[model samples]
Target: MSFLLGHFNYLIVVFLMMGGLWITFSSRNYIKRMIGLALFQTSVGLFYISLGKVAGGTAAIVLDKTSKAGEALNAHLSPDYVARAGVDGVVYSNPLPHVLILTAIVVGVATLAVGLAIAVRVREAYGTVEAGEIAELDRTEAGPRA
Candidate 1:
């Protein structure tokens, strides 16, 4: 029960990845192919973001104004407070994954842009942008048989 819910995002990420891959590989339409690429790329971004999240931890940025110079890190919690606290108090999402996701997001955007540009070119060259049409045209251009 708890385990299933904990790993739910992984399932979503897997589904998204497969769906995107299928769209990218199986489609014939130029725009459709680009759409699939976008989905696939976004799923990657989702994967990274999912990894970076910490349950109750604060954001990763350091304080510029509030901290006194060279203040030692220390804290004391009463027994009741310690006993009542869930894992949230100790859990911190990995900052590295979040940073990686940020880069991946930028890469995804670039990929989407390139894919769209290619699709436009394909449409201009083929007259019809449908996948089957493009393949048929390509086949016909290659040669004809009786």
Candidate 2:
């Protein structure tokens, strides 16, 4: 249907989110879980980027009033459009989502690095990266503590 076609990006986002969550929950390997977490983060970023887009919109850049291009733009715009926009008829896309996503990407990478480092340490300490194995090792080490 038209509705489904129109919202294809959202469908992809949802799919990625569910797949990531499934992988994160179902996997026993620390590295696999980290990958799933990264996938989920990427889907979130993509969703934000999709939300920030506007139909027939350009970048939200202000043109110099004195420039020829600005003058031409103003001349081509209708009075009502100029009145509404306070300048020209150009529709600008919101940049806030993109900026926030950039920040999230940096934080995600740092978090992934820390997670991988911890996994490496766990592997060295427990001789395995599987959650079940690690837990078993811990329980055996504890020796049925009261």
Candidate 3:
């Protein structure tokens, strides 16, 4: 259908999100879970970036009217058109979502790094990265808690 074709990026985002969640929950290895979490974060970033996009739109940069480029842009339009359309008849994509996503990406990378470091420490202490094995070791070390 046209609707499905038009929103293909959304479909991919949903697929990535579900797959990442499944990998994170179904895998017992800490490394696999971290990778899944990263994937999910990436999907979220992509979704926000997509949401900020506009068809036939330019970047939200302000051009000085006295600049050559701005003069050239204005030359293509009539005063009436400029008054009717605003901003020299140029359509700009929203930058807020993109900016927020950029921050989210940086935070995501830091969180992932911290998570991986913790996993590394867990591996060093337990000699294995499997969650079940770590739990078993903990239970054995407890030695029948009353």
Candidate 4:
């Protein structure tokens, strides 16, 4: 298990995505479907975060001048040691995915709110939120199609 442990986040991502998909597809209630869509959106965000992570990585903060000076002193002591240290320098995880995910989350919430609002309107108009019932009502109201 080290490999399994290392990649566990991906498994959770898949589970969440699949669960969301199931709810969205199988639920008769529009609200439940919207909740599933939100769940799916969350899973997508998690997936992006997981993919953007770097093992043993830190934030992409710039090193201060003092730290750079200390590193220079250490480098002069031993070239080989400095070479190794340089190779193992602070690894930074990518920030773009996290930023994009933040934007996506805002968009997802807005979309969910709009969807719920529409669902509310639909319920008011049709007296129910079940898609099948709404379709039946529509058919009855429309009569036979030529």
Candidate 5:
């Protein structure tokens, strides 16, 4: 279908996001979980960038205007000129998503750093990084679970 062909990137993004989620959920190693989390974050960034992109578009930037002889005297008429001059009749990609994703990337990296630090502390304390083994140890410490 034309729709599917036109939006193939979206499908890829979905697949990537799903794969990352699967990895995060199925893996028992804390390091592997962090890697999966990073993959998920990357996929999210890709999705945002794709959403911001246009098939045939330019960057969104307004142009400056110079006043003509008659327009100089009639300053009130400048609004019309300003509006027309600002538009270049070119389709442009949305920039808000890109900006938002940039911030998300920064936050994601900070979160990853903190997560890794926690994992390291967990390793030092438990002598193992596997989540299953950690859980068993915890269960033993607290006695049998109901």
Candidate 6:
């Protein structure tokens, strides 16, 4: 069940990415294009999140779990205890992906805002929000200008 859940998360990310790509290419409306851009950015975020997660492993911070009530806890947790725990003395999961995702999220929002702004401008100038109309108007204008 857990494996499926893990894979499902990544699969959904891929699905979202493909949906966004399809929308981005298939839409004629500026708004729809912007929606697709936003979806694509969100999908990328999902990808990063999916890549960063570690199954069954807690965050890397060593939470002073050493018990003070008994010396046995200290004895067991000595250097030997770390060696027995397994590879590299700790199963520390890489956090770089998480950090990068945080930055990417901020950048994604900015990109969406910029895209929407351009879409609004396109709609204003062309008197229509459709990509087809905007392209048509641009072509007509260019034909005369040249």
Model 3: residues with Cα > 4 Å off, grouped in runs: 63-86, 142-146
How accurate locally, in lDDT, is each candidate? 0.68, 0.81, 0.81, 0.79, 0.76, 0.69
Stretches off by above 4 angstroms in model 4 are 63-88, 141-146
Residue pairs clashing in model 1 are 28-131, 29-131
> Candidate 2, which ten residues in sequence have the lowest lDDT sum?
137-146
Question: How far out, in Å, is residue 119 in model 5?
Answer: 0.1
Q: With candidate 3 superimposed using the best TM-score fit, by how many Å does residue 50's alpha carbon deviate from the native? A: 1.5
**Tens digits of lDDT, candidate 5, 1-146:** 99998789889999999999999999999989999989998998999888888544445653222435333423444455444433443334687988898899999999999999998888878888898888888878852232
lDDT of 4 by residue, 17-104 (tens): 9999999999999999999999999999999999988654445564432476445544434545434443344345678898999999
TM-score-wise, the better of 3 and 4 is 3
Candidate 5 is scored at a TM of 0.74
Better of 1 and 4 by lDDT: 4
Please give, for residues 1-146, the per-residue lDDT of candidate 6 as tens digits. Answer: 98987599888888999999999899988789878988888888878877876543335554343444233433445566545542344433457777887898898889888888886776666677886766777778542121
Two-way lDDT contest, 1 vs 2, winner:
2
Tens-place lDDT digits, model 2, residues 95-139: 899889999999999999999999888887777889997789777
Q: What is the lDDT of residue 93 in candidate 4?
A: 68
Tens digits of lDDT, candidate 3, 1-146: 98987799999999999999999999999999999999998998888888888654557797665678666766766666655554656645678988998899899999999999998888878888899988998888642232
> How many steric clashes between backbone atoms does each model show?
2, 0, 0, 0, 0, 0
Candidate RMSDs in order: 6.5, 4.5, 4.5, 6.0, 8.6, 5.8
Instruction: Name the runs in model 2 displaced over 4 angstroms.
Output: 63-87, 142-146
